[model samples]
Structure formats: structure tokens, C-alpha cells
Target: MFASSLAVVLLTLAALLGAIVAFAWAWRKGHFHVDARAATLPFDDHDQRVARPWETPSQARERVQAHGPPLPPGPGEWGGA
Candidate 1:
């Protein structure tokens, strides 16, 4: 049991050390230079897909009746409506 505990402690220390080294390497390579650009990546053209907005139960039932159950929209559709 003691040996297993020692191994776990060693592994934890190694993981922490590795994380510190990786962070240092990234810092040196200017990965942190452009804070705003990184923050806006989710808004880029390729990544700008909007999440499906919530609909009330009545709206869902109406949509199902009109459109035969909800599905992902085609290119021109907005919310499949």
C-alpha cells in the first residue's frame, strides 16, 4: 500500500512538472501574445455556427406538426423554420 501511494505521489508530481514545462514553452513561443484573437476564435466564419435556441413545449409541438419533427436546418434556413 505504501509503495502504491508513493507511485501515485510521484506520478502527480511528474504531471505537475510537465504542465509547468508546457506552459513555459507556450509562453516562449508567443502563444499568449494575442489574447483578443484567441478569445474571438469561436466567432470566426468556420466556428460561428449558432447553438440551437430553446423553444417552449407549445412551439415544439407546433413545429412538429408543421414540419414533421425538428431537424438540423438546411443552409438557407434559420432555426429550421
Candidate 2:
């Protein structure tokens, strides 16, 4: 009798765990994300094919010359720029 009672408890626990796992699996696989698209997107199917921003000549020059002719550091901070 004790053995049968233990088995019942074990089976009930197993069923509960199985149901929880099944629900999680279905939620992950199904269209549960549809309603949350607005909040979830702008990242989910993120724009992979975005066009590169046009860089003006001055912007390019600023980026390229920001380092400027390797000016040496002053005082105790040597090792060229």
C-alpha cells in the first residue's frame, strides 16, 4: 500500500512537470510572440539590410584627420599619437 501511494505521488509530480514543460515548449514554438511584436521588434527582425549613411567630405576628413599627423604626446605621456 505504501509503495502504491508513493507511485501515485511520483506520477502526479511527473504529470505536473510534463505539463509545465509542454506549455513552455508550445509557447516558444507557437505564435505567442505576435501580440508583443511592437515591443519586441525594432530588434527582433532588425533591419539587416540598412543602407549605409552618406558621409559628407568634411565628415570623412574629420574622421581621417582626427588623429592628425601623429602629434607626439607631451610630458610623461610619450609614444606618438
Give per-residue CA lDDT, model 1, range 1-81, as digits (tens). Answer: 466988999999999999999999999999888777678654533223322347677766775665454555457445343
Among the numbered candidates, top TM-score falls to 1
- Alpha carbon lDDT at 25, candidate 2: 93
- Alpha-carbon runs more than 4 Å astray in model 2: 1-3, 31-81
Backbone N/Cα/C clashes per model: 0, 0
Under the 3 Å rule for N, CA and C atoms, how many clashes does model 1 have?
Answer: 0
Compute the lDDT of residue 44 as modeled in candidate 2. 20
CA-only RMSD, every prediction: 10.8, 14.8
C-alpha lDDT values of all predictions: 0.66, 0.56
Off by over 4 Å in 1: 1-3, 36-81
Candidate 1 backbone collisions, by pair: none
